[model samples]
Target: MTGAAPATIVFGAVYATVVGLCVGSFLNVVAWRLPRGESIVRPRSRCPHCSASIAARDNVPLLSFVILRGRCRTCGESIAWRYPAVEAGSGVLWLASWLVFGPTFDGLLAAVFCSLMLVLAIIDASHLLLPDPLTWGGIGVGLAGSFAVSWTTPRDALFGAAVGAGGLLLLIGLWYLLRRVRGMGLGDVKMLAAVGAFLGVGGTLLTLFLASLIGALAGLLLMVRGRLGWSSRLPFGVFLAMGAVVSLFFGPRLIAAYASLL
Candidate 1:
């Protein structure tokens, strides 16, 4: 499909980025509350250190962090930089989605996919937990987007979900048999299934390969820093989310390049 004019694209990207920043603020709530089994809506974002309610002015995504100097206004406790970082990262991802897919339904779907991946990545990295709401909800959204957008057919999305979950399940079983321990969590399997629903089998496979490559690199880095050992657990979901984002943007070109090389 033809893209929009340069001016229109620029405007759309900016608009999407702004909306993403707001969404990222809410995502912070989701990542924090969901793992704790708390209601994200009712609590209204209090400082974890002092239990002071955040004012509306203090909750303006990246801007608030800057204004507050990354400290709680009430108690001066240091706020995590991850809050503003997620907001900025989400804005960038939204801008990238609009740039790649243009101002179309596909662009909206891409933005939503990226947002979900971001939330999953953050939760997994911090808590080593991937909640069902994000994973299962993402699967539903991905399947709906499959029919709504031109990225993949429904059949391919279905196959992708099945293979993504099934492949991981098999690997986990094998690991258990060989090591007498569960190597992968069900959350990772479900998250992959959700990714497959969006990306199809080829993209899912590419995500797995990319996740493995990056995860190994990260593990090596941790080991070198004396932070990890052979028995240390690494959060695989974060790498999977990263790989899915990369595949979302570049899977087609990457697959084509590999095919040409073959």
Candidate 2:
């Protein structure tokens, strides 16, 4: 591995941890407010338990979490540990993607995509709802990133985005017609469009298939543990995000293997 050298590994890990910590701070804002139908910008981050304004110094991502011992300074109320975990997790994923794809435009775009997925996973798990702004805004960002990177023709990207969104919408509609219920939400439809815009047709299909597989496994596990009934709703968006990430790293190989199998 190019990252085999001790110095290189150390530098990469440190850089990743720092960036992850900072991004995680912003993610916390998105998590807390998005579901409440509130803008994430107007009100500054405050302690949820005590409502004390957190100082800049005390908001130093992982460092602050550690220094404060995951508690509010004013109320001594313990903060959720997920804060640092998300920040640190995002950083590591971004750094690893950077290393794998190099410093190319695709690498940067992939990092952004992965970060959105991290947010999606966290928010969906917490509330079982994927925010439209994140998914729809991501489509725009992915399209812009594709153009910046010259990864695909503009026509291809546009068509893929349309196909991704339309295809999912159609399926969602059909499911609704037969069952008279909501199946996949609009959030998933928009998210697929964003994924297709970035990954093209083949990758999008692979992502859907992989996501379905993962979702099934997760559902089965939950059912067996008696935590979920057959009718319980699961956040399939998390699995979709997971599938896209996997395909970003190994999509081409999977395509090749499928062709050989055929």
Candidate 3:
């Protein structure tokens, strides 16, 4: 890493963080409306409790939430903490991406990928839904980005997508044949395809491994706590998002380490 001036790096980080926060705010809107099959652009943000239109000032991302003490200004109804949390988390992720990849094409791609994953993770966690707009759009972006970015080739992206989706389908089919029950949803397969498009085949495989490892741990914990049973479905998309993010940042090192071990 270049020993750039502290001020310059700080300025870049702040700029990226601000952009991420704005994107996060928009993502929150998308998450709320997409699952309901409502137009995200139409019927501007409103208080769910009182059905009052939100003013521009009251919708200023994290600032507005803090100013209002996490309540709707129009109705005084308590707002979900997820609003500010997502905004803050997005900002941190943007900052991290900028720091990792710097001001470059790869940095831009990482930031965009992180943003999409964050939004999808939140949607899946909250509503158990991963909309096509994000998954399919992500695959398109990944393929297009590979042309400009040096990390992966277009061929790798295509191969990754095919393998990711195909592997999941195979697993689902086998599980259904053996257990007469669905093992996973199409959304997960599509989401993995998107991740593979962005990260290529090796990264996609790593993502699946990491997601499964963490998800199994989480399920075991939940079961032990009596919060979940064997039949309870976990939001698998959230784990995939987590794995994608991890693989995005550390995949090269991880692959290199594994190769060394071998």
Question: Which one wins on lDDT?
Answer: 1
Query: What TM-score would you give candidate 2 relative to the actual structure?
Result: 0.88
Cα RMSD (angstroms) for every candidate in the order listed: 1.5, 2.6, 1.3
Clashing pairs for model 1 are: none
- Lowest lDDT 10-mer window, candidate 1? 1-10
User: TM-score of the candidate numbered 3?
Assistant: 0.96
TM-scores for every predicted model: 0.95, 0.88, 0.96
The lDDT per prediction is 0.91, 0.81, 0.91
Q: Give me the runs in candidate 3 sitting further than 4 Å from their true place.
A: 1-3
Assess candidate 1 and give its lDDT.
0.91
lDDT of 3 by residue, 63-154 (tens): 99989998988789999988889889888888888999999999989999999899999999988888998999999999999888878999
| Candidate 2 lDDT over residue span 1-262, tens digit each | 3637877766766675567667777888898899888888877788989899998899887888899988999999999988988888888877877677755677668778888888888888889888888988888887777677644655676776888788888877897789776767888888888888887777788888898899889999989999997557788788988998888779889999999999
Error of 3 at 213 (Å): 0.6
Candidate structures ordered by lDDT, highest first: 1, 3, 2
Pick out the ten consecutive residues of candidate 2 with the lowest summed lDDT: 148-157
Clashes of each: 0, 1, 0
Q: Residue 28 CA error for candidate 1 (Å)?
A: 0.6
